[model samples]
Target: MTKTKTLRIDHVKHPMGLLSVHVFWCVAFIVIPLLFILYYMMIDGNGSLTLDNIKYLGSKEILRCFGRSLIYAAASTAVCLLLGYPLALIISRMPTRRQTTMNMLIMIPMWVSFIIRTYTIKNIFNDNGIINQLLRSMHILEKEGDFVKFLGTPGLIIFGMVYNFLPYMVVPIVTSLTGIDNRLFEASADLGASPWKTLLHVTLPLSRAGIISGITMVFVPAVSTFYISSTLSGGTVTLIGDKIETAFLNESNFSRGSALSFVLMILIIISMLIMNKFGDRNVEGVAV
Candidate 1:
């Protein structure tokens, strides 16, 4: 009989060394930066420990900016989910080659740096841009300064978020949908369930984890985005990220910025917790 050979962890050489490298990487990058933020959050310019930074969060303007950030993020996330869920389902239902092609179309924009993508959006929306030019050529506007005013608007900001983050929502949901066994879908249909009923009871419940993941991915970045608002809104609209950047860069208040950063983290955690609970309830309801 041939001898059986099996790899064992105990026999592996330098396992600790491999783990040490990972530990060092985490400490150098994640842990150290977070510690620095916490340290800065607790200190004033005089190098004295202070609670002023935490208290600064209670100010009206800051709170309003944070609220706007939350609203914009939620809006963008909702739109992405609404648009992406259907789109992902469509893509998942395609043949393999078509799926590959459609997926490439969706992901091609992401290959470029977001800065460049955002700049392209700015050009497309700004005065004297393609839309206005087309409108003017069609006799929609007679004067040069009579642009459609797409830039510097709340709609533009939300549109930008939807454009950029829609893929984040779509891709994950596609993955989840494609992973589902077709047998389950067929079984649902065989049980005399209508298409819509099967979709609600089977497809949606199976896709809950993907939906939650997509929300987390889209919301966290959308809520904290500064450059998108800055470039598109031309400083008219400000989100929490804009406030943090101004606190650190323009005002040169590191402590306040760090405190804001801490608060943003807490807000995201709370939002995620609520979303997770909601997802669990929905799945349970469907199951019952």
Candidate 2:
């Protein structure tokens, strides 16, 4: 009998030098900036700490902007969920080659600059632009320049939000769906469950993590988006982000802007907590 020798190597540990570099970057970029913002929020023009900036959140105009932000964010998130979930499911069911092709198609718009995409959409809805010109040419409009008013509408803002953020929702859900074991579906069918029932009972439960992730991704940006509203609404509509931007940039009121930013951060954190709790309950319910 011949004895065979086996070679073994010890696992390589992460370098302390690399870890130190990451820590240095985090402290310099994230921690210091956040601390500076907090300091500014708590201080007045006289350099004295005060609570007045935080209390300004209750003023009527600020409250209205905050409420509008919440509404727009919620509406956009709901629409993305409705539209993205089905699209993700379809994509998940495609063959490997087709799935790659479809994913590329879905993500192609994201490769373009976001500002450019918004500009393109804005142009399409312009009075002399494609939609209106087509409407006029087709006699949908009574005469020249009798175009549909789409540029400054609430519906248009919501449409822009959905268009910009739909990819965020779709990619995560598709990832979760694709990660599911094929045998689970077969087992459900073998147990006499219908397709719809299997989806409701199994697929949805499994996809909860992705849904929560998508909601976070969509809601945060939607609530804080100023550029989209500014460009698409032509300055008629104002979100909380717009209010913050105006405070900092237009009025040079850093304290108020910082306070508003802090409030927005708190709101986002609360929303994330609620979503996580809801997801946990759903997972528990499904397990039961």
Candidate 3:
């Protein structure tokens, strides 16, 4: 009888050297920058942190801006969900060829610069904009500038947000909807469930994970966007984003701005945590 020799298998542990490279870059680029911002804010203060900084932010204008930002964020998110859910469902049900094309079309908007999109919206809602001209041509309005105030109002901010963030909602929902096992629906149908019942009971429940992800993606960013609010609303509106910008640029009050920024960060983190805790089970999207 011949004796057979088996080769021993060796497991290679990841080198700490390679891992250190990643940690180095992360700390250098992300962590250090954040710490610097905080340090700058502290220096801009009266050489130390103080309650006066918080009290300063409580000024009427700043507080109002923060409150308005929250309201606008909430309203925009609601609108995005309303429109995005149906659109995603429709897109998911389309033929593969059509679905691919439509997805490309949706993604095209993302390739455009955010500032450009906001300015484009500003133009469309302007007094002498194409919308007013078209309305006048159609005799929908007897005047050109009638109700043209949409350009510099909360309404326009919300509209721009919905346009920009619609994809955030749609992409997640489409992913979730498409990943759903068609057999589940078939099984539900076989069990004497109506199509509507299947959608309500099975389809919707399965899509909750995507819905949560979409809401967090859209809501958090919308709540923090300053560019869209300032540009589209002609600087009339104040959002948390605008306040942060103002703190850095206009007032030279870096510390208070940093504190406000820290607060904003905290809010985003807490909200995301709550959202994930509520819907983490349903997530099925590929992580980057």
Candidate 4:
């Protein structure tokens, strides 16, 4: 009792220091910029607070862009889920070493610059590009310019979004699938459930969290991607992101841009909330 020792907590101090740094950057960068954007969005040309900026959302062009963005985002998320879920399931069942190798290969595309990837896709789909050249060699195209056009189409833009954002969808799902208890599968089999039934009832239910996370990840970026749309659409399509970019860069109208940005942000928040509600319902259903 006389020989008491004090335990100095240096580990706690290191984490506290890291937390402080994180908070500092969050405030200095994210919070501050968002506040400034909000201010700009709410004000008039005279710097007086007004709703004119937000009211601009009622314009037909803005509405069309917003609608197109929603459609593209929804389609991309659906495609990613359809493609990624099976890939994730397959990868999760593989041997650990092989799983790692395959995952690494899947992720390799992400290491390159996003703009470069978009450009590469654009080139591949261009009238005189690889696709056309191959078709020409195979006599599928009667002449040089007679090839099927892929660029500047709605399908092409959707393809680009799916191609670029597929890894984001797969990684989270694979993580969730791998975390499922193997015994659950055994239990399902013992209960006379087929593999597909087990997957639908057990695996999918447990993996809702990852599906939600992946949807949010893919949808948000897909909605906001002006570069991919502009590059692949060849000016045939205009998304909300393209409008925002034009408002700021071409028109030099920060107020309009900020207003569009705020509206897009609100839409994203609402979509996320909806997905979260769906995920919660799935969890409750599974628990029951």
lDDT of 3 at 79: 99
Per-residue CA lDDT of candidate 1, range 214-240, in tens?
A: 999999999999999889988899889
Cα TM-score of candidate 4: 0.91
Per-candidate alpha-carbon RMSD to the true structure: 4.9, 6.5, 7.4, 5.0
Worst 10 residues of 1 by lDDT: 1-10
- Candidate 3 on 1-288: residue-level lDDT in tens? 111211122224534444555677899999998897666555545576456666766788777877888899989999999999989989989988998898889989988998899889889888778888888888888765565457777778899999999999998898899998889889999999998998888888888888988999899989999999988878877789988998889998788788788768877898889888767544443221
lDDT string for model 4 (14-121, tens) is: 555545656778999999999989999988778889888878999887898899999999999999999999999999999999999988999999999999999999
How many pairs of residues in model 3 come into backbone collision?
A: 1
Per-residue lDDT of model 2, residues 1-288, tens digit only: 111211122224534444555677899999999988899999998999998898898899899999999999999999999999999999999998998898889899988988999999999998788999999889999887588989989899999999999999999998889999999999999999999999999898999999999999999999999999988998999999999999999999999999999999999999999999999999898788
Full-model lDDT for every candidate: 0.90, 0.90, 0.82, 0.91
